[model samples]
Target: MQPHFAVPNLAVPTFAPASDAGLPLHIVTERTLEAWLSQQDAATAGWARTMGFSGAWGQVVVLPGPDGTASGALVGAGSPKSRQRQRFLLAAAAAKLPEGTYALASDLPADLSPEVECFGWLMAQYAFDRYAKNTGAKARLIAPEGVDAARVEVMAAGETFTRTLINTPAEDMGPEQLQQAVESLAEVHGATVTTVVGEDLLAQDFPLIHTVGRASDRAPRLIDMRWGSEGPTLTLVGKGVCFDTGGLNLKPGASMALMKKDMGGSANVLGLAHMIMATGLRLQLRVLIPAVENAVSGPAFRPGDILTSRKGLTVEINNTDAEGRLVLADALALAQEDTPDLLISMATLTGAARVAVGADIAPFFTDREGDAVTLASNAQDAADPVWRLPFHAPYEAMIEPGIADLDNAPSGGLAGAITAALFLRRFAGEARYMHFDVFGWCPSSLPARPKGGVGQGTRALFQALPDMLALS
Candidate 1:
């Protein structure tokens, strides 16, 4: 197993100790780029003209000192006043600069938050080379004075772990592979891991999980990993359908292209688990993942069948394509058995959430006001946006199926995200449960963020967990 690093609260480094100490930096917005450089002193102005630097993302120009040494540098932010803050530009610039520590010499505007700097550093360090070639540029940003180095490393690890898992194709990442990933973390953090596969799931009373994944060539499994001996117990359950062929009800060509990222929820929970264990946060952690592949075959569970869940609740399958919730139901029920201080389940369960919030934002559902605020605040702080939708009781009526205890999916299209939450809520019961319906893929590239399997909610949840534990 690879070595794991902790997220510590170390003493901040002082700028006086920087290798490039006293070096000046000029920040230029797009509108003033040419004019500002033209007005600079002879040596500084000469470099700008030679470089033909326009204030684009990751643009950099350096001026020479009297001894032909480096004098100052000009880094561009496309537009500082624009509402959209391009976070990765500065860090990307920092990474490409010569090997010397540098500070943000320009004055930051009053409205800019510390997150810009924090996320900038994070984006600069980002790389996912698990399976693909990644002989990429090295990250060399000087840790800003007073920055929390430990926390940033922890968050980056979480995000990287998530992206690595999601980005890998399903062929290389099945139920067993998912368990292996969990085991890797367990070994790193000295946690305990247990998994039940195929017939073993039936023995364990995870009938719904068993039924849903039986058709797959690779056997389905449930991964349960534990960490932290004492403190408030916190459980995380994530739906881990490694690949979803939509069973009998198959998805269209465009839709199935990214089915490999179906286990995004499992990736997310593991990422959050990484953060908690790395920080050595005060909480007893337990993670349950119902890992499987919903493939079509003669033995696959049909749409009209009634499936028995770990909680003993019967669910009638309204659609075979809605298999994510089926697996989550079993995992959530298992989580509730412990009745931990807090229960959070995350899944890329419904396309309705995507339709409602779009690709950039993830919508979450929770019962408590304090939990919502903390999650929202942490999400904002992390720059990983998560929106909260009501666990509105009235919508529960929509999931009520005539034939069974509940329906996998309701007949009507209205409130699809909410209805799915209500379905998962049935397994949660009175537990302090919060569910994140995340769109695990980035639709297109934006600034530092690229288009591919994107890991959404864990960063904010990682930051929020400690406070939530304290309140509990």
Candidate 2:
């Protein structure tokens, strides 16, 4: 069965008219005066004071009416100029406020853009209650004036899709299921999809992909989807390792617990594709996912075995757990064949990236300084943070194990994320390549982000594409 989750649809009525909106939700900061409280009546102000509400960030207090029923609510907006607070200020309000339709009672700070607030509000309402029952009702917020409601809705929809795909268990989100999701997306957008599965992958020269996935009962496949035929060509490749048992190497129980999210890279790529298509960005878009499950069996590829890649480079499998980069190698080789104007690869490829940048910030690698600068700026603008890590060409020797042109994973374990990027870069050729080593998970809950599958750097790329590709 397909995974089930309810994502807020931005196309519908996202806001209520001020005339009929039930509650007046005030966003207060440390500087906010009690004078605004006077508008609520003496009893409401007294209740707020008794609750010790000093407008600290994310604090919420409800005002009780004379009848002991709810009259309104007050939420902390934090500092007017702090980027961190403004990023998801409304999200806190959306999550904590009682179930009802609420509207903004006070003018938001100039720095707290309406788009950010609207997007955060929509995201905060997300709930992944597929296996469990959610008895509580969700709070609703009216879209503020002058905000692009439709754009925010599309963004929220894309992020919700990403989270849903990543959160589903491995049994339900294997290679076949991933194909189904792609087919569903194609049907919605009038895009075309082609697949090379099982022996077909070998016949088509994707030997590494076949080698890694052949052991699984679920057949592995390469999903190729194409959308739009004009403007600059943009190719996106995501590692679709449905589950990583680490193959012959094997992972400890704790390490494998969340392997279901291994395909998080593919989920995020599809999410970005959704946003691009929804906005009708002027670009010829192609998405490549080497969907596989790195399972163990007699047929599973083992460490120290050398295999020929689609790009004709020999790779020695040093560690089966590093299968993400292996599958991506073949896909990136394919993407570079046409020499697209931009080639981007994203993967949950290395724990070193997590150790360095942590889970919240996505670390990207690229040789283009200008593109790196643009991406950083766009990431900030989108409120989706990304940091650039150097390609570090000197470490290329680490990937060369003498027996083959490349090593699946190098020894010594230093600059791991960089070395993996270097390995993939060999196959990328002359294409303007960008690789994102994303954690693809939120270990804990934040304002708009939940403690599950998340879309890291996806929004940053979405925001940067128009300018990067010179699209009008």
Candidate 3:
């Protein structure tokens, strides 16, 4: 079944007109708000003091009306510097405030740009209502002055698309479904798409991809999409393991529980693509997704199997569970063959990445010093946090297993993420490459970010792309 490609309409909290808003919402910081609070009605000031509502970050308190109805709300935003560093700080108000439209009553901090406030409001309103219903109405906020409403809407749409793709179960989001989604996106943006599927992958020299996916009933494929023709080339490769049952080396029940999210890298890549196309960023963009399901069957590739990659390197499958890298290897080699100006590969490739950086922060590996510095700075500026881990040349030996040109999984298991990256780098060749080891699942809920499939590193990369490529 071809998956529907219509961009899902996110329930962005409505932005009411100032005249129609219900009550004043004062977002005050710790160091700059005592005098402002004292100037408020005496009764409201007493109510705040009685409730111990000092302006600490994330604190929300409602003021009482003359008839004891909600008069307004006071939210604690931390220092200007701190508030500027985080995204969606006002989400606490959106999630907790009484269901009514609120307007910003006081002057916002200089650091809190209109874009930040508007984007935060939109993000705070996201909820995954695919399986169940979200019947509760969310509080509305008036769009802050000087904000670009259209830009905010586009960003929200892109993020919603990503989260929806990741949160859907594997049964509904396998290889075929992934292709449909890509086709849908391409159709919307007037981009061209091509796919090499099933036995044809072998014919095309993508042996590792076919070998990993051949066992599944749903035929595996490579989704290639391109947009624009007049700018520097930017190629993105994502691991699209729709459902990783770990092939012949099956995962435990606990490990397989969330395997549905293994395709998060592709989902995020598509999300970033949406942002670029929607905003009309000038670049020649290409996206390659090696979509597959690593299932166990009589034909499933097994351990110790030798598979030739598209780059002509032989890989020794030390562990069938290490299938993400194998599929990515072929796609990466294909991407490098073009020698694009910039190439990025994203994957839910290793658990050690999660152990090292936790779920919220993504870690990236890159050999380009200037690109690394640019990405880190843009991540901070865009409020999408990322950390850099070394490519570590010495660990390259860990990927060589003596028998084959590379080992999918190395022994000792130290720096698993690094070893996996090294395995991919062999195929990336000399292209300016960056690999993101991302945890696409958000295990716990935060203010605007719910507990479900999330996009990691995408926003950071999106924000940095133009500058990194010198297209800005």
Candidate 4:
């Protein structure tokens, strides 16, 4: 039987056609509620007050028509101070609205983007119900004027692909399954995929990747996806550690609970790839994913072992749990060989990244100052939210031990996220490189975000690509 993964419906049913007719939705906040109510007739204004609609965040109240049927509704957008701390605030109100298509009648908050709001409105209806059914009257929204309908749909599709891959269990998303995803995506996008699996990895000089995954029955491989024939070269390398059991080091049950999401980097890359190809972005795109499972067996790479990478740098493994970077090291070296204009690696590399920025923010490291500045700004605008962590040249000595050219896990465990980035940088060599240490799972459900695997930096990078490539 073929391995199956759920693909959620992200394009339709959540949005009505772009026709000009939709029920009016009046957006308001606590401070502006009185002024808006003053213009209303006695009955409508009195009914709102009687329903206790004081315009707190996400508060919604429906207005009765002259003949006692539904007319329109009022939604609270909250103050700017409160809006900064949340996402998809209006979508929360949309979820509560009755099953009808609604359109914005009033202007949005000054600081928000109608594009982003529409994207959230569509994403809020997603459900991963592969084995179960999602029951609800899906309240749809009309695509607001001045927003690109196709762009938002592409984002929703990419995001749905990412969330589904990350949420699937390890049994169905191993190296082979992951390759299937790449193949399926390539088939749809007219891209080509090539992979080196099992012992063939050692033949291809991917020793670090093979060592980390040799114990798994499913085998390890490097998935290479190529698309687009013209424009600047952009290579994306994602750490596809399907499951991290910490190898021989062995993670306890608590630490291993969410290991299914360890390949979030690969998921996000594919998501970004989907957006790029579908949106007709001008670029020759290359996606490299080193898919492996750090399993424990007699053949598993040991903590004290030293291995030579594809770049020929020696790595001393102090902890088997640090396998994500090991697999990424070899993949980055392979990507650097092409000398792409910009090389980016994304991985669920270290716990210290989460310690530094929490789960809501994606923390990144890059050697290029221009990329750092542009990415941070674009991420905020895209509502993806990325923070830059330095490459820290002074800490170069931290990752070096007397035994090997690099230490997989430095002693003392301080500045772990930085040291890991520094380690991957060594493999990437002179290629202009960027790295993302992202927490790809949303631990708690909030607004449009369901409690499951999520895409961290994909959208921001999508928005910044044209600028990064100097496209006209």
Candidate 5:
């Protein structure tokens, strides 16, 4: 089996001390290129022109010194209009720099904070070389002035862990492997992990989890991880459908192509757990992941089946493809058993989410107004963009079929994401819960962010937890 916990090498000298000797990295924008050239020496001006350094986004040009070593690097920040539309603008150029360490120049025209760029530069160092021989870029950046390097490293590691887990295909990332990952992470963080697998899930009152995963030989499970003995209790529930074959109602070839990423929710929460534990945050953190493979077999649950959830709510399975919410329903119910101060659930649960916000934005629903505001501000500052959707009470009717308490997949397919959020809301009860309907794959590459599995709302949630739970 492929290594389940192979995250980016955080110990690499990606961010050197501010006092370290390194070349200067100039953050340049298209509007400032000519002005910047005017203040340079004749040789430097000639070099810039010769290299066609127009300061377009992500363009990198190394400036060689008289001794033949790199004196500095010019990284394009693009135009203000372009800068406004993109995230990690500085990282675009930073990721392309040579292997040598470089420090940010004193005269940066862009309004971005040094902390954001530091995190982005570190994020660029990620390489998923599990199966391929592709040589990724090797660039080391010095921790910019006035930045807390430790905090940035924690954030980057969390994101790297999330990406690595999602990037691994189902062949090497089954339910067993997912549990191994949780155990590995727990060991590293000095936390405790417990798992109830197979028929034990039924014995443990997790009928929905067992029913959805009974068809597969790999066996299904509920993974629980806990850390931190002090402060507010925060429980995170992630839907861990290791591989969704759509059960009996199979998805099309194109749709099934990315089924390995069905466990993105599990990856995300695990990533978030890393950040919280590594930082030694003053909070009791609990994570619940329902690990399963929604594959077809003789015992697989089918559509039109009315099954009772851990919350005692009966769900009518209108589409087996919508199994994520079923597993999450049981996990959420279990999470509520502890009566956490804050509960958050992340899931790659619906195509309707991608359709609603496209792939770039993570759309979330929350029960608290103040938590929503805190998250919105933090997401903007963290460069992890998110959008909020109402847990529309009106749509509650759509999920209620006459035969059961709720419908897994509502008819008409209108407001699918909202209806799915509403469906999970039933199991959550009255907890201060937030649900993220994330599109875990990035369709295109952008700077430090690669074109494979991506993390959504983790950063925002990390930044918000301090305020949301009064963890300070």
Candidate 6:
């Protein structure tokens, strides 16, 4: 069950009026902070000091009105730089503080984006209780007035759901369970759903998908769910390897700890789908997830194996561990068949991406310049960061093979992430394709985000889609 609200409605927080209102809020920036407190009655200063007014995390200082009653709260976020570095610091602090309405005594730091603050607050309210033997403490924050509470809830809860799904162990997140997860969303949003599984994949011509999945007992499948109509078709494809043991090209024990999040791309796609449908955006939506487990058994597909893809391209399995591209090949082929107006795919497909951009930033590749610009702009506005990496045609040779149509992996170590995108691009055809090689697992707990599976690029994509569709 969802946890109880941390901040109850009876005591929701408010912001100061227009005289103090603006984005990149210096909620407690030094300049206005001292002056604002000085203007308040002596009781305000005393209460603020009592609550630890220096702006440290977990410091719960208060402000009192002229009558000596609590006016609001002034939770300190240590340094202005600290506020920018960690989005959730203030929210987490407010969640555990005594219940009451609290206003931002000053604007947020200039470096802190509005969306960062908004999303951060939502993060503080998160609680994963699905497996909890006993309910834990509820954490809630009052939504600032003028914000769409439901929209905020959707983005926040959707992100949490994505992370939760990816963070769960593989035992609880197999292909079947992945399908069920999508089905649950379909039921809620009235989206149409379909699945192509097992032997039917062969009949339907998803040969690469069949080849790689043949070893797993749970059955490999492609999940397709659709929402919206009467506008540009926006197809979101996700690589859903529920768990990757790296096939016969086995990963070391150390490498396998986070394999449960191998499908982070798929989980994140579903999360973005949730936000889109919740907002009732004016665009047709199609979600495709090629769910499989890259396991090893006598029947597992091996290196040098050649398999035909759903799009009729032959691929040589240079490394069985490179299974994400194989499954994405089939799903992307399917997505391409419709020639959707916009085609985007997300996957935790390459470790090179993490090495290249680190965990916090998602490195994305897109075929269109306009799309890249729009996405980057939206990412800035949404405070969800992504960097555009070229689809670099010259690197296409990395996956070129002498025997089969293409190699599942490149022989050269350089440009691993770009080559992977080029590999998936082979299946994308001429559709305006964009791909995100996301690091699904967060390495450690940060202020707003916990250390676990993360849905890296969904919010930026969600924020951009509306405008992308408008132009389309």
TM-score of each: 0.88, 0.94, 0.93, 0.96, 0.96, 0.88
| lDDT agreement with native, every candidate | 0.78, 0.86, 0.84, 0.88, 0.86, 0.76
Per-residue lDDT tens digits for candidate 5, residues 1-472, read 0112343332222466667788888878898889889999999989999999999877889999999988998888788777777777657776677777788786555467677777888877777778875444577777766788888887887888888889898999999998988888888778899999999998889999999999999999999999989999999999899999999998888989999999999999998888888888899999999999999999999998999998899999999999999999999999988889999999999888898899989999997889899999999888888999999998889999989999999989899999999999889888889999998988888877888998999988888889888877
Whose lDDT is higher: candidate 5's or candidate 6's? Answer: 5
Best by lDDT: 4
Span of 10 residues, lowest total lDDT, candidate 1 = 7-16
lDDT digits (tens) for residues 1-472 of candidate 3: 1112474433433456656856888888898568867788888888888988878777889988889889899888877666655566777667778888887787766665556566666667777886788532267777767766666666666777788889888888999989988898899888999999999999899998999999999999999999997889999998999999988888999999999999999998998888788778889999999999999999999898988889989989889999999999999999999999999999999999999999988999999999999999988766677999989999988889889899999889799999999889999999999999999888987766888888888878877988898885
Give candidate 1 regions above 4 Å deviation: 1-40, 49-59, 62-72, 78-85, 89-103, 113-116, 130-132, 135-139
What is the C-alpha lDDT profile of model 1 across 106-189, one tens digit per residue? Answer: 654434454455555555445555555552233344446666656766666777677778878898889988888899778889
Report lDDT (Cα) of residue 281, candidate 6.
80
* Number of the candidate with higher lDDT, 1 or 4: 4
Q: Which has the better lDDT: candidate 1, or candidate 3?
A: 3
lDDT of 3: 0.84
The regions of model 3 sitting more than 4 angstroms off are 1-22, 64-71, 79-87, 110-114, 135-137
Candidate 1 clash pair list:
none
State residue 83's C-alpha deviation in candidate 5, in Å.
0.7
Judged by whole-model lDDT over C-alpha atoms, candidate 2 comes out at: 0.86
Q: Which pairs in model 5 have colliding backbones?
A: none
lDDT, residue 269, candidate 2: 96
Tens-digit per-residue lDDT, 1-472, candidate 2: 0122233221222445546656778878767746666676677778888999888777889878678877788887666555454468778777888888887878876667678777887888776767765322267777777876667777887887888889888998899988988887777777899999999999999998999999999999999999998999999999999999999999999999999999999999998988888878889999999999999998999998999999999999899999999999999999999999999999999999999999889999999998999999989878899999999989999999999989989999999999999999999999999999998898988878878999999989998998899998
Which regions of candidate 4 are displaced past 4 Å?
Answer: 1-14, 66-69, 135-137
In model 2, what are the clashing residue pairs, if there are any? none
Q: Once superposed on the true structure, which residue ranges of model 5 sit more than 4 Å away at CA?
A: 1-13, 17-19
